[model samples]
Target: MERFYARERMGVQGSWSRHSAARVASAQALRGRDRLRAALSAMGFRLQ
Candidate 1:
């Protein structure tokens, strides 16, 4: 259980770093709808 928690924490941190990197790279390249979709996907949500 402890190991699971630790791994989950690390995963969250890694994803946060990647998310920031992606945001910076995509900030200018994505348009409004695409930006919204990206934001939703980043938050682990999907648009239907």
Candidate 2:
């Protein structure tokens, strides 16, 4: 992990790490959006 950070700081390609990070972030965002939608729906809000 430290080696990865050092390479990243030095501007190495790091495509795999970047892609994995993006995927994780996207999944978390989707989960948060789903939770928010469910909360709103429970409050009687309708989504278009």
After the best TM-score superposition of candidate 1, give how far the Cα of residue 14 lies from its true spot, in angstroms. 48
The TM-score of predicted model 2 comes to 0.34
lDDT (10s digit) by residue, model 2, range 1-48? 547757678544556677556645865646576477779988999987
Question: Candidate 2 at 40: error in angstroms?
Answer: 0.1
Q: What is the lDDT of residue 14 in candidate 2?
A: 57
- For residues 1-48, write the lDDT of model 1, one tens digit per residue: 445547777443444556566656764744464567778889999778
- In terms of TM-score, the best-performing candidate is 2
What TM-score goes with each of the models? Answer: 0.27, 0.34
CA lDDT of each prediction against the hidden true structure: 0.62, 0.67
lDDT of 2: 0.67
User: Which candidate leads in lDDT?
Assistant: 2
Segments of candidate 2 deviating more than 4 angstroms: 1-33
